[model samples]
Target: MQKLKSKANAKANANVKNSAITTNKRLYTERQKSHFLVHSVACLGTEVHLAACPLEFNKGNSSTGACEDGMPAVVSCVAGPLYTHNVALKKKLKVSKNVRLKGGTHTAEGRVEVMRGGKWGTVCDDRWNLQSASVVCRELGFGSAKEALTGARMGQGVGPIHMNEVQCTGQERSIWSCHYKNITEEDCMHTEDASVRCNTPYMGYEKTVRIGGGRSRYEGRVEVLQALPNGTQRWGLLCGDGWSTKEAMVVCRQLGLGYANHGLKETWYWDSSNVTDMVWSGVKCTGSEMSLTQCQRHKVFNCQKAVARFSAGVICSETASDLVLNATLVQQSVYIEDRPLHMLYCAAEEDCLSKTAAQANWPYGHRRLLRFSSQIHNVGRADFRPKLGRHSWVWHACHGHYHSMDIFTHYDILSVNGTKMAEGHKASFCLEDSECQEGISKRYECANFGEQGITVGCWDLYRHDIDCQWIDITDVKPGNYILQVVINPNQEVSEMDYTNNAMKCSCKYDGHRIWVHNCHIGDAFSDEVERKFEKYPGQFNNQIMN
Candidate 1:
């Protein structure tokens, strides 16, 4: 009897193990993979990429299955979601108009209303623009219209149209009459049925409006919290706090997140371990717009599993602000005259407009005053020398300027790399500006031939034909050679492109050192050769003189 009981017990144990293993597999697998069921309006060329069988939302595949057309699905495969949820969803829309109005005229306020029972009703011209028109046309699913008519809606009750002046600068129009001025003979535009016909060439971005609201939290322990406009509080870990603006910042030097205040834009540090198996739960802000946190939450077991899978957790929370960064500033003024040099937030004692002296014609040099309005945030570093290019320094300067100024911060030749190279020498260079005092890292770029084939401005480190070429310095004895590195970034490279693919050159020697004149590298150019990889794009050329 004891022997028999032992055998039964072993069989039961095996069954339990099998059940546990199967349950674990299900928990880690993507729950909603490969389930497409969209049936709203779709036009030609509207792409529908399929997801692989084992694929799932956020998680990869559970089981492989043949498509209706009989094809195998695989992981990381180009096919889209294997299963789709809420495919029946559609988008809401609105109408807009771009009628030309006289600059100073109040009657040209771009707007119109519908006429109900001969009574004209005006719309509250809110968030009006071409994009709004695009949505309306897409929703209607008609070929999208060229223009969203305003002001010409069926005339609303003839008296003073409350906000009648529909101000618009018909972007592509040539005629003054193209946009409805206070009074234009163009009768085709009636002031009643403010209509938007669907005349779009194709359908894309139709889902922009359909996106609901919510907040997204990063994977980390909540260290600080701030009350957002709505009832919910915005939370963040030991990194920072407040809405996208400069609310607050936290740092634990031990975690490699050192203390820095000015440029909170690039700072990111999180502890992924604290994240529970949570689906993106959307939190409701005052506006109807849904933030990342506003999304629905995940199941309990799934959340725990997710947290466990990532030993070092990383969480991302949503913010309302979309930040603009690393913008290039070019100097528009050519002549250098004495003028008021100003910075943002400068104390009155330091807030004086720079004045320039008059030319030879004046009895005495007349002073021209330039008022300094605010203190400039120069938060970047400059690179003096780099290898792989003719010896030169690449200087880069960056900072956040005041919002109101139409003015821009540009590169002023503090001093050129005047290694005394004659006009038109074939050499590549790199340069940068820095914010070491502000705790920000180094930022610079190389100069080489660019897309248009000019050997001008910063050249990406790759593509030798356009990058730094080692100079033949044997014959040209080295003394204190004066060289100049100029920087002008090509607008073509985007932020992502710079981070992922741009090239950079670094060197061996740094700071000030002395050497005898004519002491140079044999097969070399500049005796100093330092090398470092740069992952950011810059606004100028990279050149160095050893």
Candidate 2:
């Protein structure tokens, strides 16, 4: 087995050594049995070919006379593109308009939405067919239609129904070029939104991109291999002028990383990689692109922060906590309570009640509270922990616990048009592994100054009986509203996914009683099933989209 492994490694090493010899891709050379020692003064000092450099090795007892920077000595010529592993790279994608994919886990699949009258709208599944879907696939530069999905298979789209009953011979340049019906309100609904899965050619784009100068593979400065018209290539940097989450999302996705924990604009701290030049600038993405090259960028590299230190960087993660609320728990444990203000002194000190409670005839009158149980589950690949350390946690005498974050979760009531009616925030004083999966021991507990975090496959539940677990609905009018519970609302903590963080339920309150229904996490139901999500779309949120 050892001999076989050694043979395998030797073969791999030969490929790398040959790559170095046939191309001027790498300069930091170390002696390997498979590598030929080479000396190049002109290639190292002056910007010239290796052939122009001296081909002699100085006679020396010490190792430092002929070879500088520990480079081995030989006589040979090497030339080619940067890091060309005898493979060809695909061309960069051009920005597309009129039609684009959205809400897909990756770029190749998404609901078949179209543009009309300067507004985006969905295509109905009345006659959704693969032939028509193939037209969209070709229009977007992909190979062909893998599948035609209907019944809002991608997810519910919010907009006008644009087209229906589409017919295509599959040779059209665009889906719009195919025979399709213009949408009308009476003809279709979002529930019948059409979607498509496309066959995308393997571009090996990830091989041409990398993160450099980090402590681990999970982070560093952004670098991309750029090819020239002459066929030569070089590793280049990305201009950091407006780089952030959306751009980082595409990058992490392209790199096969889970998600972006932090997208940094400047990477002076990780200034180690020798790659140079700001090859791309003004890069924009909708968070659905499968690769960074698929995102939009300036026609020419135009960046004020052209220096290397100001280049884009990213901290990615293969595993992160995904916080999801138990919508069913919220619905089952919701109720209205009228408690006298005198019994709420501790709650008042913690600012659990709304401002109206402050002006209420304290000790004499009662305030109405809408309470519910919130069971937040860490249904991701990593543990759910606060951003700050315990040393920074704030202690509250009223709650007898240390608050890991000032605001960890939010409870809100919204009107029909999405206007905030009433709201309350949870000061997470005790984020612990309330319960864990089978065979997993608890790692975090709030009692006796224990650590704080929700273990993966575990859940941290806030019962309705807990303090500050209720929304002060004292001034809320008796009517229909949406009750939304968002954990990690401010994004103070990183997660595998955030779309599932906000759990909402429809509520109808009639002065005396309240009913909560249709409670679910975003994308959990379909006219709502889904696979991808972000805070904003077609706009910027710590990332440039336009």
Per-residue lDDT of 515-539 in model 1, one digit per residue for the tens? 2111111111211221111111121
RMSD of 1: 24.1
lDDT of each: 0.24, 0.74
Candidate 2 residue-wise lDDT, 1-546, digit = tens:
999999999999999989977665433233422232444344432211245457654555454544545444444522122212344432233324567665444566777767764446778999887778877876776656788888766555644677889988765667787888887888887668888887765657689799989998989999988899999998899999888776787788788776677777889988566786789899888666667777889998799979999999988876566677877789899999998888899899988888888888878998899999988877555777887789998888866889899899999988766788888889888999888767788899988888899986678889998888999999998887778889887666766555667876768888889988766665443321111112111111211101
RMSD of each: 24.1, 19.2
Q: Which stretches of candidate 1 lie over 4 Å from their true place?
A: 1-236, 239-333, 338-411, 414-546
Residue 209 displacement in candidate 1 (angstroms): 25
Q: Highest TM-score, which number? A: 2
TM-score of model 1 (CA atoms): 0.19
lDDT of the structure predicted as candidate 1: 0.24
For model 2, where is the 10-residue window of minimal lDDT? 537-546
Poorest lDDT segment (10 consecutive residues) of candidate 1: 491-500
